[model samples]
Target: MEIQLKLYGSSKILSEKETLDIQLPNNSDIKKLRDILTKIISEKYSRSDLENLPKTAAFFSEKDEVIDDSYKLSNKEYISIIPPIGGG
Candidate 1:
């Protein structure tokens, strides 16, 4: 299965495109996605600012609703990654 991750905020660092395609096994959940992201970062962008993104970011469905770590992902689904925001 593949997920089209629409990049937002700091997540944009993951790729040069507006969206990043992530391949996963069938029936994989958001938790698995996070694990995969961690590996990607460690392997490719170890010193980049995305190190904590997988653990702190929030995911949204095509309908723009929040989805948790246990949410099941379907093939070719368009999801959005919302990186955490900091404020004064």
Candidate 2:
């Protein structure tokens, strides 16, 4: 199945895209998706960098409502990620 993914803020700098097409299993949970993204991010940057990031450093959603990190996802579902913003 294909999922729609969106990366925002600093994550965009690392990911280099506002959105992407993620192909996964039929029904993958957030944990699995997270694992996949972690691998993807690690490929772009360092795994330590991604590990040091706060959970709130990024936001995940299946639709509009905020979903728990453990939430499961369906095929072709939209998953948007908003990395933490920085400012003075």
Candidate 3:
């Protein structure tokens, strides 16, 4: 299955790109996607850089609804990874 990843805020900065398209096995879950993302980031940058990723970053579906790590991703689903917003 192919998933479209949309990066925002710090995720965009850290990933060095605004968007990415990744291929995974069928019935993959959010946790697997997260692991793949970590691997990709670690390969492009470093393990330490992966640590720099915001812990509060959220994963949303194409509908802009937040989904849990156990959620199974469908083929061609659009997933958005948005870092926590901060303001005073």
Candidate 4:
């Protein structure tokens, strides 16, 4: 199954488009997604720059709420990745 990853903040560097398509096994959860993300950054992107993204980022469902690691994902679901924000 594949899901659309909607990017935000530093996560925007993951792709040129607003969203990226990620393929995962059936019934995968957010924890699996995090692992996949970590692999993607390490393989396709700069590991030093994004090595912490998977651990520090927050995942949001289409309903605009944060989803936990155990949250089950459905095929073709749209998930938003929001990287950590910092300001004074």
Go through the candidates in order and give each one's C-alpha lDDT. 0.93, 0.67, 0.78, 0.93
Give the TM-score ranking, best first. Answer: 4, 1, 3, 2
* Per-residue lDDT of model 3, residues 1-88, tens digit only: 8998898876765545678788898999988887777777767765563464635567988888999889999999888986777878
Q: What are the TM-scores, per candidate, against the unseen true structure?
A: 0.93, 0.70, 0.80, 0.94
Which pairs clash (backbone N, Cα, C closer than 3 Å) in model 4? none
Report each candidate's C-alpha RMSD, comma-separated, in the order given: 1.5, 2.9, 2.3, 1.2
Let me know the TM-score candidate 4 reaches against the reference structure: 0.94
What digit string (tens of lDDT, one per residue) describes model 2 on residues 1-88?
8888776665565555678777777778766776777776667676564553435554466545667666778887887766566779
Q: Can you tell me which runs of candidate 3 are displaced by over 4 Å?
A: 14-17, 47-49, 52-55
Candidate 2 C-alpha error for residue 10, in Å: 1.4
Error of 2 at 70 (Å): 2.7
- Give per-residue lDDT, candidate 4, residue 27: 100
Q: Write the residue-wise lDDT of candidate 4 on 1-88 in tens digits.
A: 9999999988889889999999999999999999999889888975587899999999999999999999999999999998998868
**Cα lDDT of model 1 by residue, 14-80, tens digit:** 8999999999999999999999999999999967578889999999999999999899999999999
Clash pairs detected, candidate 3: none
